[model samples]
Target: MQPYRPSPSPARRTVLRGSLAASAAVSLGARPAPAQARSGRPRAAWGVQTGDVTSSSGLVWVRSDRPARMVVETSATESFRRPRRWEGPLLGPDTDCTGTTALRGLPPGTQIHYRVTLADPDDPRRTGEPVYGTFRTAPARRRDGVRFLWSGDIAGQGWGINPDIGGFRAYEEMRRLDPDFFLCSGDTVYADGPLLPSVTLPDGRVWRNLMTEEKAKVAETLDEYRGVFRYNLLDHNVRAFNAQVPSIVQWDDHEVRNNWYPGQILDDPRYGEKDVDVLAARAGRAFGEYFPVRAPSAGRIHRVVRHGPLLDVFVLDMRTYRNANSPGRQADDTTGILGTEQLAWLKRELARSRAVWKVLAADMPLGLVVPDGAVDFEAVAQGDPGVPLGRELQIAELLRFIKHRRITGTLWLTADVHYTSAQHYLPERAAFQDFAPFWEFVSGPLAAGGFPANALDGTFGPERVFVRAPQRANVSPMESPQYFGEVDIDGDSGELTVRLRAEGGTVLFSQVLRPGRVGQ
Candidate 1:
């Protein structure tokens, strides 16, 4: 976790953006102005969302402007006729005024319409306007088709919420797709990437950022980390999108710092606190409070989200239990990117899964060369083209297990390189050829700065069939359209189609795979 001295490279720390536009004050909608939170009966302007959903249960989340009692009413229809009432937690500052309500006994494959009401903690009659939301439960039968979106790297590299171009435009675009759920691959918050008021772009356009005190610098304290999440929620498009799409959220290094790991002390002068473990702990707490995830334990971020008979998403926590960033040339390293325990858990879950498709929702790309500095590596792969080394050994082990065990219908989805690409890994072309052929889809930078593509490591024998990356390093969103990926599973045909999409509904790349099959 002790990353070396920072350099000006785009792969290291994200470069910032340009000046504030005159229309910077424009609101996205569900986010209220500062004054409204002060004088009103507890407001739910932050909006409502649900996540980790199953056929019979899910988690509902909301935030209040003040200390209030959370109340939820759910019905089959939006009309609220014969609704079931669920009394939730008492929102307070302990959790940054945010809390999640666990809803159970829901109808499978049904659309759930729910509204969140924030009642004053002391006054029974004083309440805020209800913030409504909806989500579809996982199907109980195979005949029900399923669809969902996956993307990450939100508000990173100094490109923050820009009200002028409509803050976080990608969320609005993704919300319209109406996916059953969104797998927020990782880097859900750029706590380390601070916002500047404005900077002049290369082409003379002034890119303005919606700034706050905590966003002005790196998030170090717990409140500052909470502000990082709160800052993103200020975008009206994000809030509006949350009201519709439930998300399966996870975290990456940017949630705490750039290319961070466990137990490393910081060498960077930008930070006053040198211990990274302390920083990661605070970041994890804020992440749990902000995101609607069904973590198995208090600090666990890895879990399998079962979506009935069609799919099961194995969300990985590459950041939490990872071995320190190294040169990645170790001969015998059992504790690599995913520590031994997580690897075991993943193997157990993959073996137990009976779904047609098992999506490995990894925070970082598997075969890409993500460097921690000039020497150390960040992700699963380094530039080595030889047999499995360091983290590659762990990945090789997992792949060999899949091939040997005859576990079918597994693919990888990730977003950290700030680009969209499709890669196919074949054992025939790999140094360690004990694995079956599989596909890995990458997409992201939801509302952040885009960067050039990273080089692939040959140990996995990955062929980049398709890629859409920025021409230069740290390209602002204005110069590049944001990206996301979608998956559609046909219940009748049992075929899964993956589409890499850009902002404004353009499908950049796509591929189709048959169920329980390989080498598509």
Candidate 2:
């Protein structure tokens, strides 16, 4: 249970004036609220997180509230002195009390400092009261350059957490861009978007919503998808951006409902579980027992997350191998969306990558066209302008095997069509061009509700150049502004630079590239 390496907002005001930083989007503090135990301990109140990491290993989530025992320690300083304990796992309820701990060796790009506490599984001297966090550990040196922050939809459609604007505040604006990790890039949760403790807004405002009872609906049980992953840890900017970022999480199809595939069958009556593979196997075992990954299988997510010699990050779980939603002009499909053994394990991990930025990440949005309704097709360009049909013939066989294996620095980050973009693709503006010319980009929802900006499907000819969306559709997040995506790289100019920010981090659009380039 503890083997495999491992690895791995609240607010106030405003003050964003241009080109990136000057700070002041307010409230990046507040983390109290689990006191009053005095002695009988066993707490952890939803905080400590870290994931995937690599280089020397990582991982360390926590969740307790009872039956405790997780212990974790680690330290590179935060005054933890000679630390490095680890032990974790036992907070039961069959994974509801959540757990995850792996640590191992460590010391790659430095700065670790963990914590966690929680004992009392029968009184090992009653513990609890630790919780701190910190990350960073991938660089083995390419001159140590790489940064992160990709986004995802969280608490969607009915948009939860709104402590008068101090909640899920775009995860404290991508945790003040401290990024060493965080890719999420999917609908982390929206398990069919529920919530509602107030709404009204068509302009009259109102919004509100902090709801819980499994977010007031839709998540069909496995403890209602572990209470929608403990409802974004009741946000303090998503637990202070999971205590200083370190994540690689993946999953699309709203984490379990909208646009769900893999033998889908629910005609949606708000589900009594008309089997969308039994509500995606209880929302993928409550999203792998609340996200520190490993031990997943139902609706299995894809893998690869290297991060060292300058990024690898493949991630993609395009909904557990697919081929459902229709109208994608099936001209003899072969499980189109990454299905045949995850397309031969992503063409054998992009032909044994040696890292220099591969990052396919993607959870939808190949060329956008998203529809799933008026005729099926829920992603991977089904608005076909001809040629490659059905999930663009498995992304045209992984872009003709990365252009006949000349693979170099791939790229293609994504987030389900919720705004922010940058396409590019070409082979002379394709309709099925055999490949070489990349860059996909696309940002996200971070704190849900923002739509508008979908159609582009020229069977991968792409070329959007840069978008910013929201002219309507769901909107609200105090009326639009919450997208992410930022890259960086550049260790003596291996140059990657992406940007596309917003919601106080601003930058709105940027591009860069260069590094054994294919399309610039």
Candidate 3:
């Protein structure tokens, strides 16, 4: 992945008072310190994580204290010793001060412990706090079955009381099940619009001022996005859980600006030149800084990751490269949905895929039908289906691609809709059978704030199965404010079980989505 090289904009120091104040105040045992909270070196942090148990490789990342070379270590245990190792230099700010090291020649499915050490130019004792973490590789390519988790939209406001509303509980419950790795469907952080003025909590006093409403109505900006991300990452449980497993992420509306269509800069009347561009760039920069992704391809938001033969995950960028949002636009069927090039790429990958299962991950629902019995592409944008023919052609191309490919073992995961539910759709074959069989698991709001209901039955047409959790299932007992999804594949039996769990440790729903096995 190449580093970003945009012209430097004025760096905005994020206001830590509302989001990071408590942590800083407790750490310093004082009211507050200006940007320089501590007197020494900057504290270490990590973000945007993913990994695979390659036949002979593994990867790791951490934020740098300065532009210096980093040493990456892997061991069978936390105690570093005669285990395998790799080292690399994080060239410059292009990396946004984050370092990625790919270590090679490791055993498969090995629970190798790892950490990064910062080396200084002059100091003899240049090092970091071991930065302890762990990851395992994929099973042999021919391995029969494998399991992983997937979910999205985990966040609350930067200053809200119940920050855990965005699936913080889901993170804790997921730790107990401990799947191979997790999939962040989309909307990992709602950077919303620009950074607004955070209500100052000076002297721990909550003000009931009318100005708060005035600030709320203002447009979104870069600072707001950064503050939201900073606030979310501050959660200790989220950080700890991520340290143990690799998480693959793709962004949705909230990451940039809400309900944003390509070229539509949120509420900007000036279009391209508005604050939307600035905010988008900032959110992307922050996402790069905090997440472990292989950079966006050609300004198009899409990429594919292979987890050996067990699964092939396609992460798509639905926001970028989208046609402008409006009514009566021209229909260039060749360029919508996945765009001609990206759609072609996706089709080629699907045809060539030898993995047991293929997971298509998008930020929004693919087959979502609205109240009027029509696919509402512009529900967020109101009645204007903008360039209706173009959008429909895009949908047609995708449907044709899926049907022609006979792509079984393909499951869909999405976020941005704060709910936990799923439905199976099959557009191929003469008759439209309810059990035609392809599942879509939707999870969001790590700390859910919106109302959730039976979205499964509501979205995917009238007839859909709503499975109940089995009695005596060995599930967690804690109450979860956030929601998430999980899938477990038993290689020996070829059984892939998927489930949605609430923060309260209760299994909201579960289904054994058995691929390769039909009927009794």
Candidate 4:
């Protein structure tokens, strides 16, 4: 297969020149540091994070305020009395002064305390303030318990960094939970959502958002897309949270634009460019550079994460391999969601996995009706109440394969709806009955607009067991309810407990299911 390459655009060239000029200015001390960077302090602007963890290895990510050589020191002790140093990738203008390093030969189930150091690329003698972080590697033993948090949609709907009382307080609350890692389902950044300085609420009160030049408009240039990622790092709460907790991130529509797909021409007035593919290419590159995810082998982000004998997380890249959102039926309708290659990979991975529980960390829901304009939109449900059509055909086939293979203990977790809900799918009550019954938990919008509930399609028999949505649309985080989900898997009994939490760490719903009893 040919590698997926981004097409060249004139806007991308302009972005490159701008970034290079900015880097040169920073190096010469002609420009001041970013708002988050203190005058006297060292240049660790975004703090540090660890991610993509396994039993014996992990990845650490850092971004500097200027060009620097990145270095990491890890130890079992937090005091750093005895540490092992690992040289990291250079933080340069190419990747917007950001880089990542893979740490290998880590001890499983052991807490690893680490600190990041940035020094002058030319002179290693001058170093900056060290940012500390800790991560417990995935357990190699089967009896070790597992706990992680999952959420999505950050800094959306004109909600940007608020310097008043630390931006995005939900992250601080999530950090306090002390989970091993965070599964960021999607919408890590909203390149399409422009940030304004302030807006008046319905009650006549003014809400303020900390704004930057790049975030004030739609991200058409590469620097603008990179700025979308950089904008979130300006928040102190986000930085502190990242320094303490690792994350497994995926991208959704907002990461490029609202409900974008391949080869679709956007008609939104906010965007100057109508080509969705060009925007997606820039967004994809920025997302890869900013996050700690490994490079995809097949030019797609669909991969499996095995956490010993406890769980296997199948992170699906629904957006990359999806067909355009349109209504059609032809002799060959194979151009659906997941495509052909990804669906085959998913089935093979599911069949070969030996973990007690399989978690499908999907970016979009299976039965939710997400309509675009007046006609069609993205997601598995094509609004067809009868037989499967469009993406639903691919989903139906996958479900049938799972049932045929008797893949047990599989649960789906997703976030894109900007609400919290627990859904149950029964094969007997559905349009399709070849698949086994399963549960899907939805939670998200860590700090974004709160939306109302969405209707479900009957193609897969999704019943809302519990749902919590805002009464109004586009509600602010100050008065609106934000949500996240947590999963805890018992070591001995292999029971998985799922919890949907609100802004201040309140559990809205809770359910516990054993491995063998999920479908039943």
For model 3, how does the per-residue alpha-carbon lDDT over 64-145 read when each residue is reduced to its tens digit? 4345456677787655677666775552455545556767777776666766565553442655444556666777754545
Model 1 lDDT tens row, 268-316: 8989998999999999999989988665238899999899999999999
User: lDDT tens digits, residues 1-520, model 4?
Assistant: 1111233233323322332232222232122255246433236656677788888888999888777788999988766787999999788778888889999999999878787888877668888767677778999887888889899989998887766646799887876677878999999999988887898888997778887777888999888898888878767667666766688888888989988888989777877889999998888888888888888322456788777789889999899888888762322557577878989999999999888899999999998887776777678886666667778888888889888888899999999999999999988778877788999999988989989998888889889999999988898888787899989998888888999889875788888888864374
> Global lDDT of each model?
0.85, 0.77, 0.54, 0.80
- Pick out the ten consecutive residues of candidate 3 with the lowest summed lDDT: 8-17
Candidate 4 local Cα displacement, residue 251, angstroms: 0.4
Q: How do the residues 1-520 of candidate 2 rate in per-residue lDDT, one tens digit apiece?
A: 1111111111101111110111112122222223343346766666767888888998888877656789988887766889979788887777777789887789899877677788887767778557677788988999878888788988788888888888887776676666788889878888788888999888797988877777778888787777777777767667666777789898888778898888878877877878788788888888988888765644467889798987799898877778788888877778877788888988899899888879899888788788877888777787768788777887888888898888888988988877888988887888788888888998888788888888887876888888998888988788888888888888877888888888875687788888886555
TM for every model, in the order presented, reads: 0.92, 0.36, 0.75, 0.90
Number of colliding residue pairs in model 2: 9
Model 1 residue 305 lDDT score: 89
Better of 1 and 2 by lDDT: 1
Q: Rank the candidates by lDDT, best first.
A: 1, 4, 2, 3
Candidate 1 wrong stretches, greater than 4 Å: 1-40, 295-297
Model 4: lDDT equals: 0.80
Name the lDDT value of residue 413 in candidate 2.
90
TM-score winner, 1 or 4? 1
On TM-score, the candidate that comes out on top is 1
